[model samples]
Target: MSNSAYRWMVAVPAFVVVAAFGVYLGTTHGAPTALDRSVMDTVTGLRTPTLTSVIKDVTVIFSPVAVTIWTALLAAVLVWRDRSLVRALPVVATVAAAGIVGEAIKLAVSRPRPPAIDQLGAVEATYSYPSGHVMGTTALVAAAVSVCAASVGARVAAGCLAAATVVVCAATRLYLGAHWVTDVLAAICVGVGVALVVPVVLAAVIGRLAPHLPAWVGVPAANAGSKA
Candidate 1:
């Protein structure tokens, strides 16, 4: 099979594995147990007062805004201006698709949040299996790393920053009692699955289309900075 076909094949299996694992976790551990609660609490407790306060206050801050602005800018620069859309589109599209998939999985799973903490205000709705925040952020970071991979030093820096951000975001969710550990893990799987599939698919499309685009449009966009 061709590379594009191979990517699609891999995506199908990876998505299935993530979805199945999410289902198992949701069904077997629908509710957070005492142990789950204790672990979350311990992690929350370990945060310094300043850090905890910042996390509590800014847990959801800038995520939606950052994703929106970055995606738009990247798409416009790569697609419309530089014709490198093939390089940039996958990252934006992957992050957006992952957000949608994460929400869908949460709806299907319908797991509840931890019952032991008052760190975060209660969420009235059901379906808390996979955290949208974690999944979405992971997708964004992965995309950032891919887009900046031309430079080895930049790639290394991006990777470190991305890893740190994911850790902090996941920890913040648990610290604020917004999601369970299993939920975060499921999000990670879903995010990874999406990250792996998007670029290869887009690269294949780009290979076919790049030859026809304007010369000026094929230039690579400058790396402004890491978004993670």
Candidate 2:
């Protein structure tokens, strides 16, 4: 199948699952499932000061201020790599858009952040049906790997590293009782879906217009022209 088709396929199913998961969590916010409580017990049970501190740091990487700083840093890297703001928009957009979607889900669900009795870390003001930290990390890492990596091998390596980051971010949320297990799971799905869909859609649109558009509008051309 064509790459664009494959991306659309992944995007649609992934978003559907995320949506359904959100609805489930939203409708059931008042009631906790056996699995949910069990997992919470297990994660909360295993928490320690050292691990908690480490996970808190990991979770902070996706916090508003941290994400902003990280986005700026990533943009700088992309600019250094491709030297074109036009070419970097979709990559940056992937992360930003995922964050927006995650926030929207939180608003829509209005699920309370984990109760303090369950929390090892400070309870955030934001709702917690889907973990934005996981979403942002997933999108940020995927966006970076997709847009910044120079070769198949490099992309593969980046993907592995990004996946590890996502896992750590998600685990930290669970460890701190900041989110339910499925919240992190859905974030993973949404983040990955958005990351894949954004680049493919952007590339397809740009490739079609590459001939008619200004000389500075092509990603691959920009990529070829600049690398650091």
lDDT for 21 in candidate 1 is 67
Query: Candidate 2 — which residues are off by over 4 angstroms?
Result: 204-214, 217-228
Return the TM-score for candidate 1, rounded to 2 decimals: 0.75
lDDT of candidates 1 onward, in order: 0.69, 0.76
In model 2, state the lDDT of residue 99.
83
CA-only RMSD, every prediction: 4.9, 2.9
Q: Compared with the true structure, what per-residue lDDT tens digits does model 1 show for residues 1-228?
A: 764466567667767776786667666768675666777868766767777679866666425566667667766765653344445666677888887887787777778766644455555355677877788878887777766565678889878998888888888788777777877777777777787777765555555677896654342322323233
Residue-level lDDT for 112 in candidate 1: 70
How many steric overlaps are in each model, in order? 2, 0
lDDT tens digits by residue: candidate 2, 53-167: 8877777777656766788887777666555665467767788888888888878878776678898755566787678878888888787776667777887887799899888
